[model samples]
Target: MMIILKSKKRQPHQTEKTIQILKDKLRERKIKSKIIVLENIEVFLNEKRVVMKINNWIPSKRSPVYFRIAERYKNASYIFSKYLEMKKVPFIDNYHTFTRERNKLIQMFLLAIKGISIPKTYYSPAYDSRKIRNAARFLKFPVVIKLTEKERGEGVFLAKNAVEIKRILGKNKGQEIILQEYLDNDFDYRILVLGHKTKLGETRTRTNKREFRNNACVGAVEEFFPAEEVPSDMKKISEQSSRIMNIQVCGVDIIRSRKGKIYVIEVNFSPGFTLDEKMDELNQTADYLKKWHEKKY
Candidate 1:
């Protein structure tokens, strides 16, 4: 069976490496695969029929494809996924699940409603000062302001007071921001879940002493740990979060407060992988897809 990896034209260094690793693993299994950059994709509908061509080549309808598009191109991804579904092509993470999981606010709302522990979050697109002040009052000082559409800790800010909050809001005018209760933790865990199973667990700690966000893109270091070393509760919750999001593969970021309460910070549908752990994740993903292809075809 053919495997297609869809991603942006300009992917980060790590993302490019991860894609190469996945391609290699699939090749080892003798599965035909190719990478399709979304920038080169064109979709057209004529005579009540959908037509999709990637770099002037139409993908086979029988192949299973995986999307690696980032949040910015989510709308395109949604449209492409819908076309694939209409053509009865197999793909990982449908459009609905992909779009919903990309929104941090929506993830927290859905997970919180299901009794999953999440940091208290408030969002407003209008940037109303009264609502901002109310969020400050409800969540208290030292709140976290996160841009709803960003990833890799790009637009995360810590506000110690209303003045700082106002300043941030002013600077980010017209942007949707979510105010979350800041949980003071030294480090957080990034648990990779695939096929409803916890495959790999890692601890992300900020290498910069002053940095509160522990993202590898921003000077954070990641170290792989055995699955058994992770807390049972964390593992269970990570798996549950992925399932609830209707995602087959994801990275669940969980943090533990000083009081030992576990709170899920975020769930990443397209989680980054380090050089050391890339092979393991790709191998498992390939095996799972192979099995899926066997069962379906």
Candidate 2:
């Protein structure tokens, strides 16, 4: 069995760690694997024989002049995903999974159609203050702002008033920003959904003044465990979201509102396991991916 793992261009350090762990797991299972870090793909000759490609990169570069070159490398991830379409591969998640997961608004819209409750969300291009202000006004104050394509809780801010929104947009001009209702909850769940199954889930809390943000990237603690028995309806909603989006695996961030309603905050395509980083869970998720790849390939 052949497997290919792709990751973002920057953050080579963290990607290296994940690749190592995955390589070790496949090796332990006596499976042959090929891992490709996309940003540095000039090292490998383009080949069509590879099976199971995992893509983790998002097009977030500064200049469109280099986009074609970057796209060539990014497209290789799709090529590998297509290879899985032809034969039995060890493990892989396709390009569409990455694409839909990267666009927060699109993902939310899909989930909403499947009967999942999400915060009222809107998006606008950069430099359109009037349009953004209008969307914010519609959602009401204390709205959450985010870059349309980002992970690890980066490029996200909560603005209370038009002045703060204007300040943020001024600082982050020339990018797609999403404005959404801020769910009122003290804790959030980082539920790792693998193949429609919740493989490993984590709960994050803001327990200290120094760390106000409840993101593992912001130094918040992560407590990992198997999913608490999710209601059947909720399980169906999660699975349907995954199926509709064609993702083999995802990290679903969910929140509980003041009215005690559950809402899906976001879905991550290439979610990192470092926050939990436990060997057993990693191995299990890897094994599941391996099985899924076997069926697809």
Candidate 3:
């Protein structure tokens, strides 16, 4: 069996580490696998044909298994996934799921529709002052302004009042931003769900005194806990959120409010694993792939 790991040109250091771990595990299992950076692949289209070429070689339709790990090259990933689908191939975390989870507005909408609790969020394609003001009216002060396409808390901001909201909107005139009710909490949970199981859970607390965001990239401290130690409600909601998003493996971010309400903040398609948990997560994923391959082939 051949397993292909597909990603974009530049990936995170942690992503590279996870790839190496997966490769090592697959090697030990004696499975043929390779990492195919989507940037290196070329697609050609014509009135009569469609072709995908990589390094002057055409990949076979028989290449059945694939795992997509990045969304930076979304168009390419979509085309490649369609090709594989046309050939009746199997892959982990299909293109639709990847794109859906990447969009915060769409993700929150879907989760809310599935009866999962999410913070009050407002989104619009065009930045409208009326919409912004209305969202502020509904959600009140201390709302979070998030760029729809950003991750790792890159475009996240806290607006204490309408003035801050207007200023933020003015600065990002053409960009798509969503306003969410800020849950006044010191920490949030990041739950990694694999298959139908919750593999690992961690609490990320802000290390900086002035920072409101609790992203690990922003110096948030992470403490991993066993699955049983996690709140039963959190595990259930995390798994349910992933299922609703059609993600076989994902990281679900859940936040608790000062009022003791649990809300799902985000669902990540390609969540990073800590060095200590990388081996275990990769091995579990490999075992899942093997079982899936056996059942299919």
Best by lDDT: 1
Clashes of each: 0, 2, 0
Show where candidate 2 strays beyond 4 Å. 1-101, 126-129, 210-212, 231-234, 275-277, 293-297
Q: What tens-digit string does per-residue lDDT give for candidate 2 at 1-297?
A: 343444444445655676678778878998765554443321101111111211332222221111111242333444333333334333333432243234775666456545566777655332355655566666788878887667787888988888888889888865556677777777787777788886666778877664335787786677776656555545555666667667768777777667877777777777777623466357757889799889989
**Could you give candidate 3's per-residue lDDT for residues 30-52 as a string of tens digits?**
88777765545543322134445
lDDT (Cα) of model 2: 0.58
Model 3, position 106, has a per-residue lDDT of: 60
Of the two candidates 1 and 3, the one with more favorable TM-score, higher being better, is: 1
The CA lDDT of each predicted structure is: 0.75, 0.58, 0.72
| TM-score per model over all chains | 0.64, 0.61, 0.63
Model 3, total clashes: 0
Q: Over 4 Å off in model 3, which ranges?
A: 1-102, 277-287, 290-297
Rate residue 43 of model 3 by lDDT: 38
Residue pairs of candidate 1 with colliding backbone atoms: none
Q: Which stretches of candidate 1 lie over 4 Å from their true place?
A: 1-101
